[model samples]
Target: MGRLTDKVAVITGSGSGIGRQIALTYAREGAKIVVADFNEEGMDQTVSQLKEMGAEAI
Candidate 1:
């Protein structure tokens, strides 16, 4: 099991750059991810990537 299993993480500026990377890592660690960012496109991309990793994210 991952360290963050069953945890929920809200990441600001997760649309891109370091924020996006952090979101991905948290998701991989089994945390449910809530991505918040002004850039809709970037946020969508991050969510998509998380999904592909079999991680729950929004």
Candidate 2:
């Protein structure tokens, strides 16, 4: 399992840019992600991408 397995990361501004990258990285490490951003559409997209990668995100 990854080092972050069973961890949960709450990432702000994760709808795009650096925040999104960080969320992706954490997800890769097996963390569940809670994406927070003012951009609802962007957040949805980020969640979709994470789910596609087999990551648990909301």
Candidate 3:
């Protein structure tokens, strides 16, 4: 298991740019992600990508 397994990460501005990248990285490290951003569409896209990686996100 990853070091972040069972951890939950709340990431702001995750709809795009560095925030989004951080979210993805955390998910890869086995953390569940809480995505927050002003851009709804970009947030959804990030969530989708996380799910595709088999990571839990919302």
Compose the digit string of candidate 1's lDDT tens values, residues 1-58: 8999999999999999999999999987899999999999999999999999999999
Colliding residue pairs in candidate 3: none
Say what the RMSD of model 1 is: 0.5
- TM-score on alpha carbons, each prediction: 0.97, 0.98, 0.98
The superposed Cα distance between candidate 1 and the true structure at residue 16, in angstroms, equals 0.4
The clash tally of candidate 1 reads 0
Off by over 4 Å in 2: none
Residues 1-58, candidate 3, lDDT per residue (tens digit)? 8889999999999999999999999999999999999999999999999999999999
lDDT of the candidates, in the order given: 0.96, 0.99, 0.98
Candidate 3 lowest-lDDT run of ten: 1-10
Report lDDT (Cα) of residue 5, candidate 2.
99
Tens-digit per-residue lDDT, 9-44, candidate 2: 999999999999999999999999999999999999
Better of 1 and 2 by TM-score: 2
| Descending-lDDT candidate ranking | 2, 3, 1
